[model samples]
Target: MDEQLKEQLVLEATRMLDKAYVPYSKFPVGAALLTKNGQVYGGCNIENASYGLSNCAERTAVFKAVSDGNTSFDYLVVTGNTDHPISPCGACRQVLAEFCDADMPVLLTNRKGNIKETTVAGLLPGAFQSGDMV
Candidate 1:
């Protein structure tokens, strides 16, 4: 993506931080997913009483896009209030690999504007895919 588009996506994710429902960890995260059709989906982390049920921002954005009948994505940006770029958990990586192409771009960012650009395959090396099951 171009610098301007990346900046826009980063801002979108930053804006989603306000919508997060983080009561337990108090760590809010935001994600902006760009579909191939030029649709953008924003998501915020939501915490539940049962920590295990809590949803991460990355997954939330992916689910929203999938629900909207958008499975093909071009880019994803995730932001959080951390020292460095926020890294998605193992579960989130798996979920992303399920819907996104192995080479799909994923941008991790922090509140301080630090960004780490990686790909779905880079985030989860040797990820399990449908081909692996067959």
Candidate 2:
């Protein structure tokens, strides 16, 4: 992705933080996914009273893109208020692996201007896929 697009994605993700429903953890997170088709999907972490039912920002963005018939992704930007760039949880990493290519760019960012650039496979090596079940 170009520098401009990357900056836009980060801004979008940061904007999504306002929409997070994080009553329990008080930790809001946001994600912006860029599809190969040039569509961007923004999502925020949502929490329910049943903690197990909460959803991560990364998964939300991927799910929204998938629902819109845009599964092929090029970039993903996630932002949170943290000391360092926020890393996606294990489940979110697996979900990203399910839809994005192994080398897809994932930009982890924080409100402190920290950024960690990595890839889908780098986030979760040996990720379990459909083939793993066979």
Candidate 3:
């Protein structure tokens, strides 16, 4: 994806993050994915009383595409209001790395306009694939 597209995703992520339901952590996060079809999907963090059940923004966006029968992400934008854009959790990283290719780009941005671009390899180096279990 081009820088322009990446910027758009970042903006969308920032907007979505403002709507996050995070009364406990008070840390709102948003994620936006750019599909191969040039479509964008975004999701905000939804926290639950059970921390284990809390869903991260990354998984929410990815799962939305997957549930709609779409795979292959060209790029993703994740953002928060912190000093740095929040990275996905271990579970979200594993799940995304499973579905993403090595070159899949994940853009992390903050309200300060700082951005960091990381690849699937960078985020989850040598991640375990389902085939490893079989």
**Winner by lDDT:** 2
lDDT ranking of the models: 2, 1, 3
Candidate 3 lDDT by residue in tens digits, 1-134: 67787778888898888889999999999999888998899989999999889899988899999999899878888999888757788898898888888779888888898888889888989899888997
Query: In terms of TM-score, which candidate is strongest?
Result: 2
Off by over 4 Å in 1: none
Q: How many residue pairs clash in each candidate?
A: 0, 0, 0
Over 30-107, each residue of candidate 1 has an lDDT whose tens digit, in order, gives 999999999999999999999899999999999999998999999999999999999999999999999999999999
Candidate 1: global Cα-lDDT? 0.95
The segments of candidate 3 whose C-alpha lies over 4 angstroms from its true place after superposition are none
Ten contiguous residues with the weakest lDDT in model 1: 125-134
Preferred candidate (TM-score higher): 1 or 3 = 1
What clash pairs does model 2 have?
none
lDDT of 2 by residue, 18-119 (tens): 999999999999999999989999999999999999999999999998888888999999999999999999999999999999999999999989999999
